[model samples]
Target chain A: MVYFDNAATSFPKPDGVYDSIMKAMKEYGANPGRSGHKLALRLGREIFETRELLAKLFNIKNPMNLIFTFNCTESLNIGIKGILNTGDHVITTSMEHNSVLRPLKVLEKEGIELTIVKGDYAGRINPKDIEKSIKKNTKLIVTTHISNLTGTIMPIEQIGRIARDNGIYYLVDAAQSAGVYHIDVEKLNIDMLAFPGHKGLLGPQGTGGLYIREGIEVKELNQGGTGSISHLLEQPDILPDRYESGTPNGPGIVGLGAGVKYILQEGLDTIRKYEEELTKHFIEEIVKIENVKVYGPLDIKEQGAVVSINIGDEDSSEISYILDENYDIEVRPGLHCVPMAHKTIETFSQGVVRFSFGPFNTHDEIELGIKAIKEISKEL
Target chain B: MVYFDNAATSFPKPDGVYDSIMKAMKEYGANPGRSGHKLALRLGREIFETRELLAKLFNIKNPMNLIFTFNCTESLNIGIKGILNTGDHVITTSMEHNSVLRPLKVLEKEGIELTIVKGDYAGRINPKDIEKSIKKNTKLIVTTHISNLTGTIMPIEQIGRIARDNGIYYLVDAAQSAGVYHIDVEKLNIDMLAFPGHKGLLGPQGTGGLYIREGIEVKELNQGGTGSISHLLEQPDILPDRYESGTPNGPGIVGLGAGVKYILQEGLDTIRKYEEELTKHFIEEIVKIENVKVYGPLDIKEQGAVVSINIGDEDSSEISYILDENYDIEVRPGLHCVPMAHKTIETFSQGVVRFSFGPFNTHDEIELGIKAIKEISKEL
Candidate 1:
């Protein structure tokens, strides 16, 4: 079977990821930082190594600034809700996934002003529009680096410049771009970047992180036994520990380290280029079909690996089912938990079927995907 | 190595746990409930099965009321902070862990009235003290089933009765007593139960759960893509979906299910009995050593599978180091992240060394641990 739902989660992670997780669990599956034994210390050190690796990958100066979370959604929630207050205003784009939008919506009910900058029909968010939305009370600018629906790469660098110039905090959700894209937080002037480990990073699920710039104080979302300052009933005011509580996913973080190591060894640009080629080929051929209405920039320069399309106003779920049942090809359909993104591209009712390419997706598989879509479009 | 940090996290989980996690990751590690594909459907079904297994264990009638969390800390935070309002009052015990105390302390500053019922010198809380502390404005009663530091088992059944009689919600932190001890939510009148999957349940790290009784309304801590409601900007008002947002620890929960299955197959009584015997032998022998002050009820019927002791006024860390370095016995020596419990037992300064046994611990290991303590006592 061919899998093309890399946007949701990347399957068939690197062999080292699986091996590292197994070894960590079988050999030293102890609670890190909670005990004083060798196994616990070893696991704790290994978890730090993973943090350092992610730090290096994301160009973070201090590893402590990166806090591991359950998923990017949690990271996004923390980044969005931690900084904004009742009177604070925030700006975001329509291209973002529900992870960023839903949190802002909830905060809106609590008197936090929200300014949603609209995107074009192709799901492209202009930095100028975001700047225009800024008010005197605007405290944050949050945008997705890559749109999960249309794969439209937002101009985060320009938006970051605007935020830095205005002294507003900038948060970039790199859920769809972390491992395969080059992101230098300092160069981009991003105060916080939230990323998932299981997608382009090729790590197992249950691993994600948020990198907060040093000296930027964001209130923690959860407080518990941080294994430090245990004598105090109050939560510790330390980096990472201030945010991370209880026992973390030790082996899962070790696997994430292996994934980052794999990416560093293979070169991020190489992996990105390979996935881009597959995406470009699939998009070029599928758009030629009679009834297919492909979405996104349709250019490798303006898009990531994700591509969405519809067949003659067909329900996205039905077409996805046909692809899965008849062609043994897997793809995601419907709104993808990003209703605003669907609305931006005028596919809220039709709900485009999304085919996302990963590092492991071969050119031959892309050809087969194009063929499957061609046949399905003809039938429709 | 003898692993006696089961209260922190259970090591060497049942072999089926590891195998099930690997199979889930390699075979069907897709985003469950996010995409409409075979792999996603398979994983979603398996996750529901785990929920059903937990519901059966806890006697929860509706499995949908159970929500998966990252750890027991998050569960406790949700259960504690979800129901309480600004003017509401809460009653808790001194035997609670930092997971319970820290969140309540945070709320105490926000106009929430908190009354901490002090436990006795034995780290045991009297149900009568809790009953006396209850006020007319009391909205919740929180307690730990077993003390993480002293292994003192609280009278949760009696406490639950008091909470029920007063129309107050009862939240049980079953961090140390989830899989080994029987927890019938309905019978105990527990409105909410918080538990860690990696502890007594013998699952992998990064998995935990909170079971909210039907009709109990608790606000969610995080909101994002729940995959159920794609169009609504608001969080879906569903049972599990409202609380569980974003990509969960898929394979981790599968391992947890395998762990619950192992407990069910081996019989909870049998597992509890074996652990109890180990605790009884270790406690009886260790208490006989001179200069060693054991903290807990010390009786098999009163205590669970945990024992804390200190040797000859020695720093608990030094003795724990000797045990790890000289005898290769793994024990935790510190406040155990429960400062109030240590203070209640009058060992706050010289924290007692904690020896927690799990299902995998044997009589031979217990004897070895006793011998190590005996030799250490002679040296002191």
Candidate 2:
């Protein structure tokens, strides 16, 4: 199958993910940390191992600092909700996916202050715009590392430095960038990092994490069963346990550890180069179509692996339907869950069609996909 | 492997669980409801199927109110954090698992009025005591349907009526009771029901759900992707989506659905009878051992499938360790994450040994287990 919807969730996970998932089920798949049985102990160790791998992957100091979540949305929710309080000010960019924008909107309605710094039409958020938006009470600044719709990488290091110099916490939502590209939390000075396990991380969809740099404390989003403190009625002040409640997705997280190992083995730099080449080639070929309008940064170097565009006279939904029914190709259509970005790029009423490429997507598949689009565009 | 720890999370799931998990993964594992794609549509249907099954099982009015969660802890967290407010009065029992207690404790410290009613020695909280504890400001009451540590079934129907008469919302933490017993949400007037997917539901470990009755609102606990309203910043105030944030545990939930199917096919009443027989026989046989003393209600019809006990001159840990290493019988030691329940039973630091039976357990296994405990008592 031609799986182009990696942004939704990477299809056909790394080879290790399947085996690890099955192994956990077959061996000792107990409710981790809830019981003192041997199986539960083994399961607990695997949960910790996954955290350690995530820590190493993200360059976190302590594995406990890594907060496991249901997905990137949960992580971002915890990160945003934990830090941004009522009467607090925050800044984010328009290029963010709905996951970032929606939470901020909720907070804004709750008497929290927010400023959405506009990214360029190319989908890149400028550090200066973010810096200028910061108010005296701005406690946190959040931006997507890569635009999910356009694949535009933000200059987050610059923003991180600005936030640091101004004594503000900088959070990067790395949903589309993690594992597909390099992210050094230390050098980036990212106060908190939110990412998906199933996306670039190649873990199962249920796994995700948040990295809070040592001291930043968020309200416990969910609290129960860390297996440590049975006496405490309230939330623990501990790192991962503070955020993580209930029995974790042990089998799913163990699979994620394998996904992390795959990334380390293959190296993110190599994958980035491959994705860049594919994006450049796909862009060069797609531009030849007479009625197609591509969005975001034109150059592959400045772009993310995703491509959002519209074929004239065709709404994104109809195009998406034709792509699946006629061409046997899969691509996400509509707002891609970011209405703000669509309105910003003037695709508000009719959302743009999104085709995101993953590491496994070959140029041959892209050729067939483009051919199908061209066939539809000719009539348009 | 005599998998005796079903209360921790039932293992060796019914055959249908694996099939459903694989089927969902192969057929409709798109990021559920995020797109208009056929796969997403199918995925959405499957998610709804699980919700419907859960609603049917609990005798709930609307399946949409059944929100998917990571585990029971998450369900309780959502239920508690969403509804409980500062200065609002809340009532819970001392027998609750940490999931319900911890979040309430946090609220307690934050100046929420909390009243902890004692369970009469059997971990059984009297409904009259609960009614007496309700203050004029009491907004909600949360209690465990079945004690996690002692397996005592609380008087939920009576408590439910009291909460209804007093105009207070009542929540039942059904972590240990879901499929092993039947619950009628409407009949009992349970405003919200929290359950673990892995236990009586017979699903994978990571899955669980919260069932909220119609016309109820809890604060949005986690805010992220609901896949329905991409334009909204805050969570949609619908049923499941309002509480369930992020990409859900699709495979685990798929397995959860299959597990529930197995329970429905066999019949919850039949399954409960099978477990009760096991619990009774196990209790009867173990009593033959000279030094054995059982905890919780001795009546099999009244309590659950769990059997907690202490043998004289033998520490629970030492007995549990010997059982696993020497006799290949698995059971949980330590505090069972319910210190208050242990205190109620006077076990305290010396936690009782727990032998929880399930649908898969056999009479021979129970005999071997009892004999092994007999040997351990002899050695002690």
Q: Best candidate, TM-score-wise? A: 1
Which sections of candidate 2 miss by over 4 Å? none
Against the reference, the lDDT scores of all candidates come to 0.93, 0.84
- Runs in model 1 lying further than 4 Å from the true structure: none
Residue pairs in steric clash, candidate 2? Answer: A102-B233, A151-A304, A233-B102, B82-B219
What is residue A154's positional error in candidate 1, in angstroms? 0.5
Residues B197-310, model 1: lDDT tens digits: 999998999999999988888999899999988998899989899988999999999999999999999999999999988898888788888989999998888899989999
User: Model 1 RMSD to the real structure?
Assistant: 0.7
For every candidate, give the share of true A-B contacts it also has: 0.76, 0.63
**Candidate 2 residue B116 C-alpha distance from true site, Å:** 1.0
Interface RMSD, every prediction, one decimal place: 0.7, 1.7
Query: What is candidate 2's CAPRI-style docking category based on DockQ?
Result: medium
Q: A1-380 in candidate 1: lDDT tens per residue?
A: 99999999998888999999999999999999988899999999999999999999989999999999999999999999899999999999888888899999999999999999999989998888988898999999999999999999999899999999999999999999999999999999999999998998899899999999999889998889988888999999899899999999999999999999999999999999999888888888887889889999999999999999999988999999999999888899999989998888899999989999898888888988998988887777
What's the TM-score of chain B for every model shown? Answer: 0.99, 0.98
Model no. 1, DockQ = 0.86
